[model samples]
Target: MLFFLLLTIIICVLVMFYIKWVKVRSYWAERGVPFDPPNPFLGSLTFLMRKNPSLWMRDIYERHRSRYVGVWLFWRPALVVNTPELARNILVRDSGNFRNKFMTASTSDPIGSLNLLLTKDPAWTGIRKRVSLAFTSSKLKSVQAVAAAKSLDLVTRIHEEGVAEISLRTMFSDYTTDVFSAASLELDSNTTLTGEGAVRDITKEIMEFSLPRGLAWCAIFFWPDMAELFRVNFLPKKSTDFLRRILRAKFKAKSVELNKDPKTVLEILMQMMRKSQDQEKAYSEDCIMAQAAALLVGGYETTSSALTYITYLLAHSPRQQEKLYQELLVAEEKHGHHNMEGVIADCQYIDCVIKEALRMFPPMAWLDRVALHDYKVDDSLTIEAGTPVYVNGVGMQVDPEFYPDPYTFDPERFTAESIPYTYMPFGDGPRICIGKRYAMITLKNAIAAIILNFEVLPCPNSPKPAEAEIQKKGLFLMPGEDLKVKFISRK
Candidate 1:
């Protein structure tokens, strides 16, 4: 009798699972949405561990050629917006209904959960308002000074460490770390020169891609429930602990000095904390530390990856590189070599080059958001509340309909008037990246310094920019391989 009962229970469980699977598989079909068939176990995420998300998004966009494509995040239905019109609607036109992102870190990890990037709703609004104060025009002008000094350091470093042996990504990371540390933390860093420092070590760890770290990031991005259940942290514990220790010490020593004049990013946060009547409620120590940590992670990686790609592309495209060099020469004649702000303000060709590079290799390729209510996607489909939506930014950038010769590296493409709602390397709407201006300045200064000092050439046996391997492990679109280029001194 016991054996018969156990067999009956197993049969019933299997029947229930089959019924649920049928419903899950037929969801997009029933709605008349275009979609690829999902894998039963991993849903539409069979590519998670094997492929890069940006490449996956591009594939989906090309496969459908529709306004949107339906996908599954482990049995949960989601939408990928392909067209710029729909992207605008989701990201900007109806942004109020999509203020919060679907991506989240585990609540158990305060440093990860409480940042401006990951935090949601009322908290995000308040934090964003406060953080905006740190990045005003005057504040960025001060940051430009730091970037200028560091660009000089970068040229010196490249001259000291032969370009043939230097890894572009690692070298750029070192340069970005030093610039971010000096500008945001008011701490001097020699990483750009020596490729070693406490801050540089922390940034290096944050960029490291281990299987566990990659899995943690995947969970945090695509499966928030799993992230919470598994207690995966967005940042490594040791990195956060180091940041806290350094932050606390700095805060303790500089509290009085910053009260008089808060200049740096951290100091600006401290000033906000000082003025807040409800200290714990408004800007708790954890919240303050979280922003600092976010600055480090967001600041270093995006700029470095962008620099790596820009340098690599310039190396391979000699004609375009000459065009840029000629433009830089004109700017140098007008503003002189040391005037970074003047060059950045006036050099149109460099801006085009940067835009083209970002279009080709966006660091964060997709924009994620969740619908607040039953959202009307179109006349045919009204997605249910709590549906995850991803705007395929990089996909649209590379689409032939939008950009002619999309595979080719052409700065002249951006010289023409661009289609509306198409390009967003820094994202769109109110929730766009806060550090956009700072990043642009940093890139401008570094590019000018390098182009003025060295003629970047492709190394022997190195892959072309188009053929470079995209990082399969990390969420961001970074180089999987060590991209190298030979820098011949222009002088």
Candidate 2:
């Protein structure tokens, strides 16, 4: 009698679980939306077999070609916004309902949770508004000075390695690290010339997501419950400690300074903190460190990787390179050769090349947002509140319908009228990259300095367009293989 009772209880529990799982799987199907059947456990993510999620989503986007397609992220149902119309509706028209990003780190992870990139608004709103003031035209120009000095160092480094095959990614990383340290933190990291510093070490560790770190990030971004349950921290403790130490040191050093011109981003942040405190308000040091970490993370890998891609594209397309070279030469002649800023500003073709490269490979594969309320997407579809919405940037940007012969690298395509809602390399709407101007200035300066000093050429090891390797997981689309380029001194 006792054995029979235990068996009956076990059977009832199994039946209840099965019924709940079925209802969860039927979420999108009942809404009249097309969906891929999810795995019993992994859901839509089962398709990912050591593949980059961006490329996987791009495949799904191409197959469905629907305005919106339903999929499951792990056990949770998600919507992939495919068409420009749907994207605009979610990202712009109903932005208020989708203001917060879908991902959040565990609350236990203070360094990872409090960043501007992940922090939800009302807090995000005030922080963004204050930070935006630091990236103003004059402030960016001042930051450009650091980039200019680093570019000179970059040219010197390349000159020393004349016509030798080298990893462009590493070279660019060093340069950007130096510039970020000097411009944002107001420190002479000197990684560009000497190739070693605390800033360089921290940036490397932050971006280098090893297997465990990658899994932690995956849970933090895609499976919030799992992350919270496990208390997963995306930023390693050592890296967090390093950032905090450096920030505290800089803050302490700055406190004693008599002059306060607010030249660098750190200075601006300090001034903001002081003003906030004077008004009888409290701004925690952790919050201040979070913002500084955002700057460091934002400025480190993305710009360097972007510069590497731009160079690779230029090397592959010699005709385009020649055209760009001619444009740069003309700009230098019109303004004196000493005017690096003028040269970077006037090279329209160079700008076009950068835009095209970005279209081909956006830093992040998709733009993510969460529906804060029930957003009526169209007559047929109303995304439920709390659903995850992902705009397939790689899919939309590469679609032949949106761009003619999208695989071909043609800068002329940009000369025509801008493609609405399709070409968001920095993202779109209120949440677009706040440091876009900073990125552009830094990229242009590095590219200009390199092109002026070296003829970027393909090497035996340079990965062809079809052979480009995508990292399995990270904040941005990082290359898995070494980016080799032969630098022939043009001087």
Candidate 3:
């Protein structure tokens, strides 16, 4: 009799869960919204079982070209904005109601949580204001010099690699790592030349896309409560601990002299820390470390991957490559090769190439935000508080309706007319990427330096544009395969 009673209770609980899940799944449909039926377990992401989530999201975006489309993030209803008009309303018009990003893993990892990327309104605003004061035009120019120096270093190192087929992704990764290290930490991490360092190793480990890490990130973004239940951490403990140790050691070695005019990002943060004693200004030491780590993570992989893609595009489109080479030559002769900062600023074609590459392959693929309170998107659609909303950035950029023959490698399109909210490589509105200026300078300097020093030729085994090996699941949407290329010296 006891055994039967226990079985009956277990069955009852299972039935109750099933009923709740069904109701949650149908929430969007009941609101007169078009939606794909979510999976019983993984919700709409069950398709990830067979295909890449980025591609899967793109597919959904293609299927629904109207105002918005509904999808479930593991039974959590999410609205993906398809049109620029609606996107503008969400991103800029009603920015206040959508200030917080849809990711939450702070409880699991305190240091990782303090960064501006994850923090909510008042805290984010305060940090942003204080941090923005560091990235002045003049200060960014100083960082630009560091990028130029690193670019030259990169060119010198690549040439030394000789006639060997080199992985462009790995090579660019080293260059970007060196640049970010010099800019943010004020340390010379010559990863490009030496090919090893604590900074490089730790950043690589933090950025590496693994199965467990990917799942944890997804849990944090899609279902924070579930992520909290399972104790999901934003970054690996090993990587975070290493960064903390490095920062702590630096702090212990010398008393930071508060500079009136700070040059490096680390110095700027230290200055802020000195003045952040007021309870209102919460620029804690952990917050400083988190921002530095965030900058490294943000700059490392995205710039490298972007440079690799542009290199590949140039290799396949030799006409455009030659045109860019000629442009670089003119700029070099006019400004001198050493004047890479000036050279990049003048190269209009280079700007177009980078913009086009970003449009085709956005770093994050989607910009996720949570409705802070009950918000009305349009006359027809109004979502409740805590609903997840995503901008299908990849979808918007690649849509044939926006750009004719969207798959073609044409920088000319960018040079022609500008789309308002469509070309968001660094995102849109007040919450746009803080490191965008630094990233652009680094990309331009690196690409110009490489093109001036060597001709980027396609390897025999180079994958076709459509056949590139993109990761099935990862935090960032980027190529997974080795991009082998031949570097024929211009000298």
The model with the greatest TM-score is 1
Worst 10 residues of 3 by lDDT: 47-56
lDDT of 1 at 357: 97
* C-alpha lDDT values of all predictions: 0.89, 0.82, 0.81
Off by over 4 Å in 3: 254-259, 277-281
My TM-score estimates for the predictions, one after another, are 0.97, 0.95, 0.96
- The digit string of per-residue lDDT tens for model 1 on 258-288 reads 3365567978777766755345456777788
- TM-score, structure 2 vs. true: 0.95
Each model's Cα RMSD? 1.5, 2.0, 1.8
Candidate 2, residue 314: lDDT: 86
Residue-pair clashes per candidate: 0, 0, 1
**What's the lDDT for candidate 3?**
0.81
lDDT of 2 by residue, 10-107 (tens): 99999997998899899899999988888878888864437777778778888998888888888788899888887787788889998999888887
